[model samples]
Target: MIYKTDMKRWLDLVLSIIGLLLFLPIILIIMILIKLDSQGPVYFKQRRIGKNKKEFYILKFRTMRIDTPHDIPTNLLLNPDKYITRVGRFLRKSSLDEFPQIINILKGEMSIVGPRPALWNQYDLLEERDKYGANEVTPGLTGWAQINGRDELPIDVKAKLDGEYVKNISFAFDFKVFFFTIAKVLTSNGVKEGRSHSKSL
Candidate 1:
C-alpha cells in the first residue's frame, strides 16, 4: 500500500498545484461571475467526513442562494433548483463549482480520486461506507461513484461503488476514474437536482 501511504499524497500535492495554476484564470472568472449572479460569498464551505471519519470543510463555489438551508444535501432539499442562482446552474452542470477542492487536495484533506466525502450529517452514507472500510481512505474531488452515477444513485449503491474503489485502489484504477470523470462532466451526465426519498439517520 505504498501508493496509498506515500505516493498518493505526493501525487495529490503535485497535481493539485498544477491544477490550480492551470485553472487560475477560470477560477477567478467564476468567482467574479458568482459574486455578480448572487448576493453571497463566492465560496461555500461545508463540513464533510474525511479519512478515518474525521471532519473537514469541503470548499466549492457558492452555487446556491444565501438563504438556502445549510448542511443539507441538495438531494434532500425540496425544489433544490429554486435555491440555485443563475450562474450556479451552469457551474453545477459544468462541474466548475468543484474546482476549489484543489485547495483541499493541496491541504491533504482530500485526494484527486477516491470516494467522494460524505456530508457531516449524512449518517446513512457514513455508516454504509463503514461496512466497506471506505472511510479509511482520503475522500476525493471526483471519485468512482461520482463517475458511475453521481447524485442519481441511491445511498447504498453509491457506498458500494465507493467500497469497490477502496478495495481496488491503485494508480490504474484512479486513472480510469479520472478519465471517465472528465467525460461525465463534459456530458453533464447523472447529475440530479433532488431525490424523492426522505432523509434517514
Candidate 2:
C-alpha cells in the first residue's frame, strides 16, 4: 500500500529543523549538566515502536544515575519519584531532556506532533495500540495526549486520543497543538504524575 504522507510531515520537518537550531545550545548545556550530575552517558537511547510497527531508537537526555533501575513501568510498581535525581527533576519539569528527540524527527523517525510513541517493552499497551490506530502515523515529541491530560490520563485513554489525532490530523490541527504545547510548557499546566517525569505507566 502506498501510504500518503500527510502534509503535516513537511511541517514536522520544518519545525523540527527550527527546533534543533533554537535548542542546540540548550542541548549542549543539558549534556554538560547531565554529565556533572551523573556518571553515565548524557543521552539515553531506547527502542520505541513507530509507524507501521517499525522500531526506532528514541533519544532522551539521561536523567537518572548510572545505577538507576531499568525495570519497565509494568514490571515494577514502585514510585519513580524515588529513583529520579535532583537534576533529573529539573530537566523533566523543563522538558529539556526531550530535546534530543529533535534528532529523531530530523531522521524521519518522529513528528513534531502526533501520538507519543510507546516503548517496545510496553507490550500490553503496544498490542492495544492497534485498537486506537496508534500505528498509523509517526509518533511525536508532543501530542493531544500531552496537552489534554498528560501523565494524569490512563494509557487506554491516551491511546484513544492518539487514534483520534491520527484520524483528524491536519495542518490546522498541528498548529493548534504546536501553539498549545508552547502554552502548556510555559504554564506547566496539566503535567500529571506517574507519566511526565518517567513514572511507571
Say which candidate scores most in lDDT.
Answer: 1
Error of 2 at 159 (Å): 1.3
* Residue range 45-141, candidate 2, lDDT tens digits: 8788888889989988877766655636522425667666678888777777788888899899999888888888777767777997788788888
lDDT tens digits, residue span 1-201, model 1: 998789989999998998899989999999999988879899999999999999999999999899999998887787877898899988887888889999899989999998999889889999999999999999998899988878778889999999999999889999999999999888877877756632211
Note the residue pairs that clash in candidate 1: none
What TM-score, over all chains together, does every model reach?
0.95, 0.87
Using alpha carbons, what is the TM-score of model 1?
0.95
Global lDDT of each candidate: 0.88, 0.76
